[model samples]
Target: MKKERCDAASGVESIELDATVVATIRFKAVPPQLLEVDIALCDAAAAGQVDMYNSTPLFVAATGGCTGAVDTLLKHGAEISCSVLYETCHYGQAEAVAILLDHGAKVFANTGQQNPMCAAARPGSVKILELLHECGFDINPSDQGMISTPLHEASEIGYVAVVEWLLTHGANVDATDGAGKTSLHHAVNRRHSDVVTSLLDHGAQADIQDTVRSYRASRGKYDIVQLLLANVSNTQRNLTVTS
Candidate 1:
């Protein structure tokens, strides 16, 4: 997961540099003062001077891995629901995810544009997907003001594993968006062939043209045109032979 910013660079120290540390370092284009803070925290951790619950240390550790500061915060007690605490989870910070979970971070707490489960699905992280499920996130909860479900997002983004996981967990294959279009509509419109195949295999309707067809036709897949036509031809043949 990508780190939005490094809290460790703010004159605090954390324990155990993890992915977030790498992320911060990679973003060296940031201001030198900000860079100094991260260096100080990393230095303190290396020197064993940083303690947990210092917001900087906590944010660093919460964004990834088991740092001494993180452990200290947990041992001495810290608010897991801190507003800034959501960044690590939003970026798909797995190790930090585990640490936060151990520290009782609210898994159900909404983060980003959606819940962590949905956010994880966007990145197609199977580990995060499984964790969110284990944490009791609904696989097909009501879309959070989006036109579609998590399946729709995953399929549109070509995240086959996420689409498969959500389906196996009872995500409706034909679940519709606000415009009454299914995941198939999203996959086809996005030209995600794999997602289209997956949705079809799971029984997504092939001919679900909605009101926006005129506007979306340029993007809608022609390959799916063949599939829909084939189904029609087969059905017509069967009807004529029977008649």
Candidate 2:
């Protein structure tokens, strides 16, 4: 009998398993209210689940300008020093940013790729920039790695108001990026005539050359090229008269 049992066990295949012996799997249906309670009880559980881009629920809420959600997460002890701060700035969520800052988020914190100030520049909102400045961040913080100044970002995107605000805050108009390109170079290259004008009004050097091209010859925008040339000539004439 023992020999016969051993032979039967050896002959059993995966597909030959008895249906009655197989484990049954089932999901219990819960009421919506109960599900909500369960989620609330385990709210901390999903807080650490990151998406493919490594963003958490708080990051999503902050980036979407959801101040209420941000507040709730902060109350739940979510981390305040993550990229969500930069996301708030990037999306122009001034209120969300303020909430994060009030909870001890660093104004100049770098989120691996860009800092809050750099993110704010992309939206070109003077209000956001002012908030960051009021929080004690340097208006002219030195560039790190490949990151450019806020002025460079604002100029490149043609944000006249933001450019003006940065200039008023004493941002270096001639501050260069990794390639030695100044804000004037960015504005002219992107054909933002108004931004280029603003930079020149703020004393951006018209003759500064980047690694590959001078500000005047950086782009095919005729008006920008003409503006740079005229500004350069005027600067030279003023210097000659002074001398």
Candidate No. with top lDDT: 2
* C-alpha RMSD values across all candidates: 9.2, 13.1
Query: What digit string (tens of lDDT, one per residue) describes model 2 on residues 90-187?
Result: 89998888888888886444334455777788887777777777777676764353468898888888899999989988898888877677888788
- Deviation in angstroms for 220 in model 2? 6.2
Give the least accurate 10-residue stretch of model 1, judged by summed lDDT: 45-54
lDDT of 1 by residue, 1-243 (tens): 222334445644343444445445344455545544544444333323233333354554555443444555555444555332335655666766666666776554544334556566666777766766776666676456565677877987899888988888888888887777778777767777677677777877664444123224425566754554443346553443354
What shift in Å separates residue 148 of candidate 2 from its native position after superposition? 0.6
lDDT for model 1, please.
0.58
